[model samples]
Target: MYFISTSSPDEYSTKVDRMIGENMDLTRDLEFWMSKLPACLRALPIIYLSIPGSHNSFTSNISGGSIVSLDSPKILQNLEWIYCIRHIMANWTKNQNVAVKEQLKAGIRYFDLRVSAKSRENNLYFCHGMYSCKVEPVLNEISTFLETHSKEVVILDFQHFYGFTQQTHGKLMQMLLKTYGTKLLPYSDHMDHLSLDYMTSQFSYQVITVYRSDAARFGQPLFWPSASFPTPWANTIDHNALFNFLDDKIKDRKDNVGFITQIVLTPTLTDILFNSCTTLEQKLAIDFEDLRTGWISKQTPGRRGVNIVIGDFIDLSDNLFTKTVINLNLKLLRDLPKRMTSPIN
Candidate 1:
C-alpha cells in the first residue's frame, strides 16, 4: 500500500522511503510482514538465497551482503560467530516451539534448551552449535546425539570451517550425497534474505552442511513479482514487469554457454528504486534493480557445460564487484525500504 522513506536527500529517486508505514509505526509493520509465514508454508518449499536488498530505514535491520553476491571482507574471521548466533536463534526458536509442543503431546521430555551463558564461555563463539572453546568435542557430542535421536539434525556450515577451499566445497557436496542418500534439500529459495527456507526443508538428521556463496546485492522491502497482480508497490515503477525488461541476452543458443565477466552498474539505479517513495517498499525495489543490473543472468551454452553457484564470495572474476559486509545486526541497524521485504517468520 504505502512505502516508507528515509531522511536522505535522494529519497525521491531511491524510493527507499517505502520502508515507512501507513501509520508510521515501524514495529507494527515489521510484525505484520513477518506474520504472513504460515500461509507461504502451506505451499511447496524452495531454495532460499538471501542477498542485500534495499534498506528499510523504518525497521531494525540495514540489510546488505547477500548469499548470492559475495562475502564481505569483514567476515574473513567474524562470519562464524554471527552466522552461528543467528542460525541457532532462528532454528531453535522457530522449531523449538513446534518440537516442544509436539513432544509434549507425545509424552517426550527432551525440550530444546537454549545454550545458557554459563554453558557458553564468554568471548567463546559457537558455530552451528559448536563452541569455539570446544569445537571438536562439541561436534562429537552432537554427532552422538544424532546417532541416538530419531529426528534429523542438520549442522550447516556458514563458511566452511574445517577447510572450505573450492576442493572442500566439492568434497562436502559429495559427502552430503553419500551420507543422506543423495539429493539432500540443499536449498529452499534462491535469494531471500529474511527467511529460513534453507534449513526448514531439511527434516532429517542423516547429514550436516556447510554452505557458501555470496548474494550480489541486498535488501528488498516490497518487490512486486511479475506474477503478482493488483500491484503491491502502486506508487512505484514496475521494473519486475518481466516482459518489459526481458531482453534476449542469450537468444536461442541453448548449446552455447557464457560468463558474466562484465556487469554494467547503472548509477541511476538508486534513483530508479526511490522514484516514488522512501519506504521499505521503495528501497527494496531499488535493491532488486541493483541485483538485476549487477548480477543474475543466463548461462552461456558452452562445450564445458555450466556450473551455477548461488554465493559469489567475491574473487570469482572480480571485474566490477562490490566488496561490503552484508549481514544483519538487528539490534544495531535500521531496515531500509526496498522491492522485496524479508520474508515473515
Candidate 2:
C-alpha cells in the first residue's frame, strides 16, 4: 500500500530482541524459579519436599593417590591376581565424576562426604576406601558456590571417618567451624520446619553439617547425629535387590529426620572381575536411564516421592539422572500454592 514503509534494520532488530525476552522459557531454568518461589511455599517443611543429592560427592578425582593398594610381597605384586585387584580398585573406588561445584550447579542440594586422615600427608582427605582431594579445597569450592547462589541450601554429611583418632576428629571440627562459621546451621529439634527461604534469610548461605561420630561432637553445637539423618547404604551387586531396597526405604518417611535412598548400583569383587572391560559409567548408564524413565516416574501422586535419592556418577555426560532427580521436586512445586493455604497437621 502507499502508507506501508519498512522500518530501519536496527529498529527491526530491537523489536525481535524484545519479543524473545518477553517469551523466554523460564521453566527450563530450575535454579532461577526455585530462587523465586513464593515465601509461603518456601515456609513448608523441607521433609515434605523431594531434595536432590549426590552420593560420595567428592570422589571426582579418585585415581593415583586415591587408589587402594595392598602392601604385599614383590612376588605377589607381579601376579595377575594383583593386577586384577588393582583394576577392581579403579572401578570400585570411583563413585562420582562430578566435582562439588558442578554438582551444586546441577541442583544437588545434599552431599554425602566421608573424610579420613591421610597417613602420608598431614591433612584431611575425602575417602571412599581410598583418599581423594584434601578437605579444605572442596569446602572452599562449596563456599564459593554458596556465595554465588545465596538462595540455595546444602547439607554436608560427614557420615564416615577412617584412620582418624579423637584428636583428629576435634581438629577436623575446628577446621570446619573456622571455614563455615555462621553459615553452618545449628543443630535443631525442628528440622521439618527449616525452609530454604528461612535458612537463607537467617544465614546468608546455610550449610547443615551432619557429623556421624560422637567424638566429633565435642562442644560442637552444629554437629548432628547419624540418627537424625539416616542414609541406609545398599551394598549389593544385584540391581533388582537395590531397587527393592530403595522402594521400601522411600515408603518409610520420618517427620524430622532426613532420609537418603541410594540409587546407584553397588559392584562387589565378583562384579569387577567379570565386568572389568566395562567402566563404571558404561555399566550405570543403562540402569540409570531405566530407573529414571520407568521406576522414578511411577513414584508420584500417592507417595511423597523421594526425600533424597543419591547416586554415583551424578553428573553424567547428559545430566539426565540429575535432571530426573530435580524434576521430582517440581511436582511438589505444582501444589505449593494450594498446600500453603491448607492447615498444618
Which candidate leads in lDDT? 2
lDDT score for residue 65 of model 2: 39
Per-residue C-alpha lDDT of model 1 across residues 1-345, encoded as one tens digit per residue: 112343655754344233222223212222122122222221111111111111110111112211111121334235534653333222211211122222222222111111111122222122212221222233344344444443333323333233234444344334334444431333322322212233333343233232333210122111111111101121223444432222222232122221111121122334533432233232433345346434343322121211111121121222111111111111111222222233222
Model 1: what TM-score? Answer: 0.21
Model 2's alpha-carbon lDDT is: 0.67
lDDT by residue for model 2 over 1-345, one digit each (tens)?
011122665654454354335434323654543465444445655655556678888877876434452222344334525555555555666788878877777777888988877657788888775557789888988887777778877889888887788889888888888888888888876676577776887556478889999885567788788877778777886767877887777677566677777777777657767787776777764556665445665554213347667777766646666666555544543443334432212
Using TM-score, give the best candidate's number.
2
Q: List the residue pairs that clash in candidate 2.
A: none
Query: How many pairs of residues collide in model 2?
Result: 0
CA deviation > 4 Å runs, candidate 1: 1-140, 152-155, 160-164, 168-183, 186-210, 213-345
Off by over 4 Å in 2: 1-27, 30-33, 38-40, 69-84, 300-305, 333-345
